[model samples]
Structures are given as C-alpha cells and as structure tokens.
Target: MADLYRRTVLVTRPEPGLSDTGFALERLGWEPCLAPMLRIYSVPMKQAGAVDRVIVTSGQSLEALRVALPPATPLTAVGARTAERARTLGFTAVDYAEGTANSLVGHLGRAGGRNSVLLATGRKLGVDLAAQLRMNGWRVTRRVVYRTEATESLAPAARSLLEQERVAAVLFYSAATARAFLDAFGEERGLLGSVRALALSPTIGRTLGAAPFREIAIAPRPEQQALLALLGPLPTSDTNTARREIAP
Candidate 1:
C-alpha cells in the first residue's frame, strides 16, 4: 500500500468520466494524472413523440435522450451507471445490461419486443450495435447524441510522468479511449514499460494487445467498482494477473 502512495496513475477517460476514478484513486493514495484521451461534446439533438423502446450503450448517449425520450418509454442501458442515469432522467422501465455491447444485444433479443427504437450514441463510437440490432430485425435509428474526439496529444504533465516512469498504472475504461491513448503516444511503447494497464474488460485488454505494458489486468466484471478493486492489491502481486475474479 505504501508503494501505491508513491506512484501516480494516468486517467484516460473523458472529463466527468475521469473525475470519479480520480477521486477513487486519491482515496486509495495514488496521485491521478488527468490526461483525458477523449473529449465528449453533446450534440444539439431534439426529438419528439415516443418510441417502443430506447437503447443506450453509453452514459453520454443520454445527452439527447433526456429530452427526446419520453418518460414512459422503456429503455435498455448497456451498463449499470447508464441504467441508473436513465431512471434518474425519468425513464420508468429500464433494463440493465452488463458492460458490453453483446450483453445489451442479448437483453433486447430475450425481450423479443425490440422493434423500432432509437439507438443513442456518440459521433465517434465503437461497436456497431445499431447495425447488429438491424440484422437481428429491429428497426434501429442511429441517433448521434454526442461527439467524442481524440486529444491531439497527452498533456505535458502526463507526458512527463509517463516518460519518467513515474506512473504506476493506467486505467482504461473503453477500447475507444485505449485506442486514443495509444494514438497520442504513437510508437512510444517503451515509456509505458513501468506501468500496469488496468482494463475494465477483456475486450479492452484485448484491444491493448502487445502494448509495452509491464502487465495487464482485466477486471472480474466490466464495471467501475470492479476495475478499481483490481488496484487494491500490491503492484507486484501476480496471483490475480489476467484472471477475472469470477469464473468465466
């Protein structure tokens, strides 16, 4: 634990997304390096009337849905936080999916009533969930609620810390952000040798394939709490490396 306090972590998610992890890292005694890999912009979107259901794959999708989606419309959220946000925004019927696009697809498939619906997402998005829904016979409308752009480069502080090997861990929340982070540092793989890459899911860990990380740890579940829990153990501990806390 003392060794953890002496190192910093690179936070690569967008602004609000980075804040919660930042606070969590601070409480755990690790300095946070705020280097947002993605910048999210809520697009001006306004729709009227109600639909059969709504599918939100990310929290940022709510940027437009909060106004466009009626209070009574049923919603399928891809993550726990996204479900909670939907309910808070007045959606009464909310179905929660584990943090994966496939899981969300399964929920709609089982529901068997995923007919015509709005698929809220970012301008620059990952996982062609909308296309998948269409293939599954659901009439999906692509709604670009927000825009996510990659940061041109890492912040000076973040770059300095990374180059100095001062950061102990780098938390990755999504493959898109991971790709953006990788792009920012393009080919400077050795600089990351001292850092552990903590990924929120196996898909994310796979997205970082062959990166020059000292080690990679995938969380038991694709949730924020699960991701943070992986950091609770000592950095040198390998018993839990590459293993999900739950049986796969």
Candidate 2:
C-alpha cells in the first residue's frame, strides 16, 4: 500500500497553473508543495498582421494574445483546457486536439486549410509546430507572446520536504519545468531515489534524464487528469473521508 500520511507531491509548474494544480491535488488528498520551476512573463505582440486563424498551445499564450487578436478569429489549441480557456476569453471559434502539438499538426492537416496561421507561443518555443505546419504548405507566422525563465531554486517548503524524504511524488507539467527542476536539484538524486516522478508526457519524463527516482511514470494522455491518475487513488481513511466525497 502507498503511504497515505506522506502524500506530498511537489508541483513544479509555473503560477496561475501552480495554484490550480495544487487545489486539485488537495481535493485528491495529496499534500501539494507548490514549487514553481519557471516564471512566465507576457511579451507584447509587436506585429501580428491579419490572419485567418490563430494557434495557441498554452493558456499563457491565450492570455497574452486574447486581446491582441480578434475574439472571433478561428483559433486552434493544443488541448481541450486551452481551447476552453480561449472560449472563456471570448474567442468565438476555437478548436483543439487531444493535448499535444504533434496532434494539433495532425488535426490541422486533416482540416486541410492552407490559410495563414498566427501561432502565439513563448519565445524559443513551438519551433516544431511552425516547421511542421510550413512543411504541410500552410503559411505560418510565429509570434513570441510570452517568455519563460527558469527559477534558481525550488520553494523552501518543497526543498525542506524533499530533504526530509517527506515527498512521495513530483508532478512535472512541461519538459522545460522538468529540466529546470533537474538543473536546480540534479545533485540530490539520492534524495529523490525514494520519490516518484510523475510527468505529464513522455517528453517531459525523458527530460528527467535517468534520475534515480522510486518510479518515473508518464501520463496515458498529456493532460492534468491523466497525470494525476498516475498517483492512484488516495488510501481510504477517516482523514480523507471528506476529500473522497469531492474527488473526481
């Protein structure tokens, strides 16, 4: 049986997302240590030009470009969550794939419109999507709508829990976040040997780079629900009776 008392899972995504994930973890009876590995800063769009469609891979990109682009512009997102976010932001037409940039490329290819697409993404990111779209004969304009900078260290609470071997798992949402976490704490592989690394995707799991974790599990799908499912159900107990009622 898993350790019900030591259900601490380090959340390594950036904020806004960090809070949401933390809340979800708490509802599932896991104690979440909010440790952001990257900081996101919105970059103003200098020239978006007119485009028939917009592509957004992350909520951060959608937030950055929601006002810059027309709400009614046909928008394609990389996942359902991002697509829903686009809709909430007043986008009239939004489409999404099954939570991956590669899947998004396939979705666009099947849709078969070679129209110009404005891709709102973070700086130095989305190279593969842009290249793939161009190869498919679509006019692609890439715009850096956000910048993500790696943090120097993990949060004090997370570091303390890790040092004490109190953390049962670590949740990594992006390859960049995984890299940042490794860069900050790679020397402490011994400390992590008993900790599980739960990655949202295979790419992020690979970024963990042979870290001696108790286990490294990748989500069946590149989404939050699937990633959390890797943790399994919390042990049933009087302490978590309330949590169980609210858990999905």
How close is every model to the real structure, measured as TM-score? 0.83, 0.91
So what's the TM-score on candidate 1?
0.83
Worst 10 residues of 2 by lDDT: 239-248
Give the per-residue lDDT digits (tens) of candidate 1, residues 1-248: 53443267778888556777777776666667777788888886656345678788888887677776567788889988889877887889998889889988887783356477777877756348877887788877677789887787778877787776667789999888899888877878778877789999888899887688888999998898888887765454322112111100
Residue pairs clashing, model 1? none
Go through the candidates in order and give each one's C-alpha lDDT: 0.76, 0.82
Question: How many clashes (backbone N, Cα, C below 3 Å) per candidate?
Answer: 0, 0
* lDDT score, candidate 2: 0.82
- Give residue 58's lDDT in candidate 2 (0 to 100): 88
Error of 2 at 129 (Å): 1.0
Candidate 1 displacement at residue 88 in angstroms: 3.2
Candidate 1, superposed: residue stretches over 4 Å from native = 1-6, 46-50, 110-114, 124-127, 234-248
Which lDDT value does model 1 have at 229? 83
